[model samples]
Target: MARRGVWELEKITLYYCLQGGSSQGTRGFVEERLASFAKENPQIQFETVIEEGHPEAVGLYRNGYKRTLSLRNLEPIEVHDHLLYLRNTWGEPEQKHSKISYGVISNTPSVQGYWRTEPDLEAPSSVRRSYLGQIPPNVPPQFRSFAQLQRELGLAGVTELLQNLGCSKWVVSGMTGVKVKSRKKRD
Candidate 1:
């Protein structure tokens, strides 16, 4: 008779935790669910590697194990910003408060800065129209009020508003050769 060889299976580790008020119940529920899930799906096996500390969880993931649950939940805005930070940290800072100011340049044409304002009109109405054109034509009735527009445009915030009616940040910075300085801090 020929001798048979035994194959060895590699071990996998999984990380999970219970947070806040119902940690005990949450931990029990997760353990029960995972056990049942593993039984139902044998193709994917999970083994609890460690039960304590943030370093342990990080190690599990680093060592090729999957995390079972998020440690915390964030608001929609917070989630958006967090993802934005992960993707890229370089860019104009996010607009927080709106401010409005006006000034004239010697070589450059006179333009408005800060909150929404009328255009010089002498330059060209097309440019002005395009700047204001960003406003959606089908604005809901509730948001059609001037107050709503002001709020949406960031006109009532702490930062000053730019007056160039037709120029967007791109055009102002690129075409007219104006530099925009953001007042927000970079993360």
Candidate 2:
């Protein structure tokens, strides 16, 4: 038979890490998030199986029969740490929302050592620039155009720019532009 999309219910297992290293708290949080997501998106069903230890958690993902969803922070797993592993039995092994792992490491042992040295990080420069650049100086009194409005108000930051432009929120609503409820008074 041909395969279908990820929404098609087969069986899926999810593994999530609990904060601080407590299995009970981690399991509770995982169950809560899973239940909430499942309830919100009724089409997706999730079943969870908790492993005994961190190694067992890893092993469950590595060799378990069912497809799994593992949720973990980018932080490194330290010695004598406990992690939560969630497993599902009905779906494909890899899904579109599957969690992937990345790492940060240093030769020095102390946490302070990593912060002292500069590393090539992919920081969001565009967002910073957009927030910091001065607003232009030719905006109309009514604030009709983006360029004129952004420039005339002398907006020092995104908050002021958005406030002056009558944008109430920052969400992408359509292809053309964000759908912001106008704050301007209706005359």
Candidate 3:
């Protein structure tokens, strides 16, 4: 069909099997709906060819390019949608999409590289080594263990130990540099 201001679509050929289960929907479309569809789009020539394989539709363009859509096992509505899609297209070979689409280009390379959740196994040992099981080297001696901290301070310390172990309410007095701020009991 020659669109007034668009590319010309010459013809569409529908191919379907006569007895295959896969062509049931295509047969239904041909028997019940094809006539009305052809009448609706009068500019294009529609032809049906009996074939022995899966159902498909091929649209030929005046520019010599053709588009094929598989209609195997599709509902009548889906088959109609595929025909509409083929009718609207320009009948050119599809282009492969790229990772970057726009014209914007970065002059500088990424310094930090791609973000990752896990450590890179391919990296150097120093870069990938983790302190997950054993204690990290940067921890202070007093912060290491309660026994070691009690031996260093020489006091029967329970609240201090719990405070060191991250209890914020039990404030330790006199040994650590922090002063205890008394809070009034809430009613």
Across 1-187, the per-residue lDDT of candidate 2 in tens digits comes to 1135333342334344343354444455454454554455454444555554431233222233443223333222321122222222333354444246334445668755434355533225674255434444553334335434434543345346677677776542222323457665779
Q: Which stretches of candidate 1 lie over 4 Å from their true place?
A: 1-13, 16-23, 54-68, 71-187
Worst 10 residues of 3 by lDDT: 171-180
How many residue pairs clash per model?
17, 17, 1
- Across 1-187, the per-residue lDDT of candidate 3 in tens digits comes to 3357764677999999999988999999999999999998887899999989999999998889989989999988889999888888776887757887744357886687755797543434442233112344565455446335444553335445555655555332323322333445569
Question: Any idea how many clashes model 3 has?
Answer: 1
- Which scores better on TM-score, 1 or 2? 2
User: What C-alpha lDDT values do all the predictions have?
Assistant: 0.36, 0.40, 0.71
Candidate 1 lDDT: 0.36
**TM-score per candidate, chains pooled:** 0.23, 0.24, 0.51
RMSD after CA superposition, every candidate: 23.1, 21.7, 10.9
Candidate closest to the true structure, highest lDDT:
3
Q: What tens-digit string does per-residue lDDT give for candidate 1 at 1-187? A: 0113211112224343444432343344345554554464343334564354321111122224322233233333342333223222222234455355333326765465444476332324575344433445655453345324434654323122443333233223212222434344459
